[model samples]
Each structure stands twice: as C-alpha cells, then as structure tokens.
Target: MRTNTTPTRKQAPVINFACPSNQSGLTALIARLSAAVAEVEKWAPVEDRLSLEFSKTADKPKVKGGVTKAQQLISDGEPVLDLPATDWFFHTRDAIEEGRAKALAEAAAEDRAAIEQRYVALLADWDAQEAAYNSKKPRGLAHAKRMVSKAHRAWSAAEAAIVDYEPQTLAEAHELLAYAGLDGKRVFFTPGETDLKTIMRNAAAAIALHGLN
Candidate 1:
C-alpha cells in the first residue's frame, strides 16, 4: 500500500503575521479612536462652542494632524488660551472676603477674652477685700457675752459685802447692786469670786423683781 504520507497537512500556522504597514495603520486607527473618545469626554455644558471645535478636529484626522493635535486645538483658541476671566475674578473676591471675615472673628474673640479676663481680675480683687474685712471684724455676739460676764463678776463681789446676805429675793439684791455700779460696768471682783451659775441665777432674779416693781 503506497501510504499517502504527505506529512499529515500540518495545521496552517495559527497566527496570521501582520506587516509593518498593517501595524502602523492599526496604531493610527487606535490613536484616532482615542482622540474621538477624548473629544466626546471634553464636551461641556457651559462651553458648547469649545466642545464643537474639539469634536470637529477629532472626527477629521487630517485636521488633528497627529497625536498632539487635540492638545494643539485646545491651546490655539483665544477663549482657551486666556483662562476664564470671570472665574478668576470671582475666586479672588471670595478669597479676600473670607480673609476679612476670619480676621474680624479673631479680633472679636480676642476682645471678648480681654473683657472676660478683666471681669475675672475684678472679682478676684473683690474676693480678697471681702476676706480681709471678714478676718478683721470682731464678732458682736462674742463681745457682748464677754461684757456681760465681766459685769456679772463685779455684781457678785458687791453682793459679798452684805454679810448673811441671803436676800429673800434675787430682785432685791439686783436693785441694791445696780446702785453700786456693779450691774453694768466692769470691775475686778476678788480671786475667790462667785461661780458663774450663782451669778446667772442672781441676775435672773434681779430682772424679775425689777419688772414687778
């Protein structure tokens, strides 16, 4: 059997190799497509004229000139070359106003702090003065008690003068003592003076008697 061994027709090379020209054509097509997509992306609501100009350049590769053509188109025009004047002016005005407002607020805060500090200092001074006054002043009730005790001692000493002086009533003794100046003024009663309880008892009796007569 004559074997038909035309080496089993090897599958044609899977990859169809492209020529340099084909590769260049593909690169140009890709670049054009990219430009067209970029132009569409640049379309703006505010500047319809600029968008239309970009679109025209993107669609006509001849007008585009090359990959840098889109950038050239944007850089060429009068409106494109000169930045939006109104936007620049508005931003500048806004920056100035913001700075002024911030400065004013800072000044106001400083003024408030100064006022508060002054008031706090005044209060501190007032508190110090009040503390000094309180420390120096004598207590009225304590002073009155001391005076009353001294007078009582004097009265007791005067009473001792009357021997066998168990006066029937404290009131009678108070009357006699008042005449001797022992009821009101301070005096040195003897060292072995009457006890506090006895003095108080006598004083109470004296007040009662004087009230009756």
Candidate 2:
C-alpha cells in the first residue's frame, strides 16, 4: 500500500458574468442562459464522478522523494482529464444561469407591485372626483327648482295685469313663465294690492267671465 501524502490545494474560483441594465432585459437574458445551461447539463455526467476522477489525478505525487513523476503522470492522465472538462463547464454554467434567473424573477415581481400601486392611486383619485360631483348634484337641482318657481309667479302676475286678453294655452303659459324668469327685473307689489296667487286666481276668473259674455 502506497501512503498518500499529497497536500490538497483549493480549486480556483469559477468566473461569472450576468448583469442587465433593465428589469425586462434581465429577465429575458436569464431565461435564455438557463435553457442553454439545462441542455448542456442534461448530456453531461454527474459532478461526483468528475470530481473523484479529477481528485485522484490531482493528488498523484508530483515528486516522489528525489524522482519527478509529474511529467509521466501528465503524459498519461492529461487525455483522461480532458474528457471531463465539458461536464465541469456545464455545472459551473448552470449555477450562474440559475442565479441570474432567480434575480430576474425577483425584480419582475417588484415591478408588478409598483404598477399595481400606481393603479390603486389613480382609482382613488377617480373615486374622489365622482364623490365631489355627486355631492354637488342635489344643490344644483334645488337651485334650478327655485328658479322655476320664481318664473311661474312672475308670469302669473303679468297675465293677470292684462284686462282685455285672449286666453293662453298651458304650453304658451310655460314659455311666457320661462321668459319672465330670465328677464332681469325686480317688481314689488303690496301684500293686499296684488299677490302672485291672487293674480293667477283672477286670470282664471277673467277667462270664465269672458266665456259668459
């Protein structure tokens, strides 16, 4: 039995290069790299087999006491070791590709969250505007109702003032009422002398009186 006394040296760190300027670009790149790595890894042998073979060859004595066996080993083991390079490259590539994919996925999730937040803010603004419009609707309707009442009163008084008059239709009365309301004038009648209700009643009385004549 040969006593194994070769000191182990740490393996060189693998190099990696995977970065993106933007989130979308990063996601696309990651996907492409991961697929390529997966295809390569599928055909490659397991890592443990490669590691064991490489370890045995690497641990073989470079110098046995005074005799140099490194040259002899290199000539014999070089071809065998060369076959495992493809498998080693595939494993290293897969690790890098998987890491990039994970990073991209995380970034995309964050982007989606940001967009949702913006939509929520916009919806809140629209709701506020709708609430304001609804709040003002009743007040606007009340003001319009008051204006209509005022016009009806003014037209009634005007029609009563005409002593010799042709009877007007309801449609014509409504038109006249609208015009009187729009006409910018303020008239003051004494409470007993002439009220709008009294004027309207008299107008009806005049119509009946004329019919009798």
Question: Tens-digit lDDT track for model 2 on 1-213?
Answer: 001211121222111223344533223223333433343343233343444554454432111112222322246545533322121111232343453455456667657666555445444544554455445443244444444344333323222332112225443333323322333323221222233344345446645655445
Cα lDDT of candidate 2 equals 0.35
How many clashes does each candidate structure show, in the order listed? Answer: 0, 0
Clashing pairs in 1: none
Q: Give the TM-score of candidate 1.
A: 0.17
Question: Over 4 Å off in model 1, which ranges?
Answer: 1-108, 141-213
Every model's Cα RMSD, please?
56.1, 42.4
User: In candidate 1, residue 58 scores what lDDT?
Assistant: 39
lDDT for every model? 0.36, 0.35
Where model 2 places Cα greater than 4 Å from the true spot, the runs are 1-107, 139-213
Q: List the residue pairs that clash in candidate 2.
A: none
